[model samples]
Target: MCRGLDSLPITCLERAKELRALFGSFLQKSDHNLKKSEKLKLSDVKELLQWKESFDHLLSSQNGLCLFRAFLVSEFSEENIAFYLACEDYRATKASKLAPKAEKIYKEFIDSDAPREVNLDYATKAVTKENMEQPSQSCFDEAQAKIYILMEKDCYPRFLKSSMYLELTRKTRTG
Candidate 1:
């Protein structure tokens, strides 16, 4: 697929939409393969990340956000896990119909005190200059920051300490 907007064919973009409609359930079935479209929403990011943990560390992998944010961000700079902030810029955002649900999950994640933190780096950065001022770090700290910091580190101690190579699972059945 042509990654560049200039060289991208109209059909390819359209096909992506078609595929989302076609295999959406299957894609949604696996947290690793996010169901994204012309735009990536905060709700989508949070939901995808939640699924990632359930899918046995699949979503927690390298530049996983980059896989999506890579397209949304300029030039797809090899960083995938930078997305999933769970909250986008509040100022210019059109107010996602899904924001309430996403917000609820964000609150729950914070309240539950999940072991890892998700990052707001990508979602907040997606805000266009014309859109809004940056959200406070507190908003991110509550939403998704700490875990993202670790996800960015890429090489965690657990993966290093484990002498056994447990086969990773990609699909989420517990859901």
Candidate 2:
């Protein structure tokens, strides 16, 4: 899991701010005709526009997933996506490795003191803890669903409205 900006050293934070400003400026200038190398293909524009159709569409596209994860990081809610992705990966784990994998996920996301703890309700956490007693592919299903819904309803809307997203879509449309 990535550390929050507040945890970064002052120099690192300054550099991050600089990068953000540079990126913002670049986006602002995107309306100007770009060199061919810098232009997004029509297909890319279509693909990016698809992300706005639904949260599932965003998650299904690799570029959309990266952009969404970055948006979540900016909002300091990246752990939600991290936990959701972890559960997706866990579901494919071999049965022989389920116990250890499940325990790792529980400790990292479900435990109260976990560094990247997700915002699960008490009941969901309890159910997940109980599920850990006999680790299986479905053990994290409930918690994952809760986090997914939370992101879809909350973060996804904000992301759609974010300057980064708006600028990209706007640029793509007119470029």
Best model number under lDDT: 2
lDDT of each: 0.35, 0.80
Worst ten in a row by lDDT for model 2: 16-25
Cα lDDT tens digits, model 1, 1-175, are 1234433345544543443343334434445554565225333334434533432343443323323332322333212222234443332345343344434434433323422223334444333211223323233332234454454354232332222111111212332
Q: Count clashing residue pairs per candidate.
A: 9, 0
By TM-score, who's the top model here? 2
- TM-score of model 1 relative to the true fold? 0.25
Alpha-carbon runs more than 4 Å astray in model 2: 5-40
lDDT of 2 by residue, 87-174 (tens): 9999999999999999899888889989899999999999999999999999999999999999999999999999868877776555
